[model samples]
Target: MNHQEVGKYWNENAQTWTTLARAGYDVYRDHLNTPAFFEILPDIQGLKGLDIGCGEGHNTRLLAQKGAFITAIDISEVFIQQAKETETQHPLHIHYQITSAAELPFAENTFDFATAFMSLMDIPETGKVLSEACRVLKKSGFLQFSIAHPCFDTPHRKNLRNAQGKTYAIEVGDYFTNQNGDISEWGFSNLPESMHNLPKFRIPRFTRTLSEWLNIIIQAGFVIEQLHEPRPSNEVVKQYPSLQDSQVIAYFLHIRCRKS
Candidate 1:
């Protein structure tokens, strides 16, 4: 499938996704990935930033709260509408638009920085998305993104648990197999049991190897700055026991790169 087809899935999922995400059902993002991504982020006070695949603008609002003027975009119209509704009530310095990450609607050197929160892996054209990000960033501008770890969160993954029912290791295969827009159906594991009847999300999967991601970034004129595998803190794990599995094997990867 192409980006448009992938976007249709997201659009269909927008309302449920926005509702659950806002209700804090996305535990990995809330307690692990976003925290780690922001920890390594450079200060963005007074900077102009673009949020690629901003979803309901949760992370975009975080950036804006940190004093950046943010332009946030997503391919799903309903997602953008939800984001705009929040912006209207909260009044952050955010501009919301329904736009595709692979084709940014801006001139070259238009932003000081850009960010994608657990979004890069959802989009079909990774290379084109990176190229657009690089093109729109000013000299020395950086782009940060997070995704399911290509090494561990493969098309085939299984968890090996100890006698205590705690994850001790992860079993993964198909590391070399690349997938483009394969449909994956699942619901947020952290959601309350009361929501068990909720329909699962149909997300398009776009998988690439670690080396392939690095090469794509390099080809898009980006110099690798840092790569992070986020592990939940002991305190966080205590609060969210399900996240303890992250300590055994990283479930997510964060990358920061500068336009060369």
Candidate 2:
């Protein structure tokens, strides 16, 4: 979608932005649910941090509370407004900005850590964003981010079935764009032929394979420090029978790559 349309969508939903952030999305939490906030934050204590695509700044505030100086950023002015507004009495310092993920506005080696949560796939020019993240971090800084799994969460996902009926979702579409990863529409969970009538608002995602993603970090002079597949809590498992081990099936992929 065009930036205007994207801005309109967030503006329309701005009122509920914080509420949703705290409501605990199954998919997002599955990849990120943690014992302590600081655990996911790693060792960024006393270091500058950036939260890219920081809608409503939940994580930004969380990081601030944990004592990391933060710069929270978003592309949508509406979202940035909501984030700043939600932080009415926030004692800690948090700089908020309206900016694109692909083209971050920061000097080289400026941050000690950065994060993008469940927003990478939605971003166009993700490679550029990753490169920018690499550019802005201090030596040995951490760049953590998340996205939906392409194999399991893409529009063309694999389906599971049984004698009774279909048990899981099915998807079928091209993984990579014919062009330079500049997609215009992207949606999921429909019959294969539905692309004609229901062309999703294609959002360009550089179709990086698992190996390719790892290589991006290595090539950008970072090292993979951790890989986590955060499962749901026992409570969520009991509350939602569909979620085995609190795993929100099609939610996100959490990665932590450290600058060398």
**C-alpha local distance difference test of each model:** 0.92, 0.64
Candidate 2 per-residue lDDT, tens place, 1-260, comes to 44434545555554444444355532334333433223565766688999988877766777787788999888877778877776666656898999887778899999989988766655545566788898999998898877655545443555455566434544535655222344444333222463346433434443455665677667777788876655556676566444542243534457888988
TM-score of 2: 0.73
Cα misplacement distance, residue 234 of candidate 2 (Å): 3.8
Residue 100, model 2: lDDT of 82
Best by lDDT: 1
lDDT of 2 at 169: 43
lDDT of 1 by residue, 1-260 (tens): 77788889999999999999989999888989898999999999999999999999999999999999999999999999999999899999699999899888999999999999988899888899999999999999999999899898688988899899899889999989987777889999987798999999999888899999899999999999999998888999999998999999888889999998
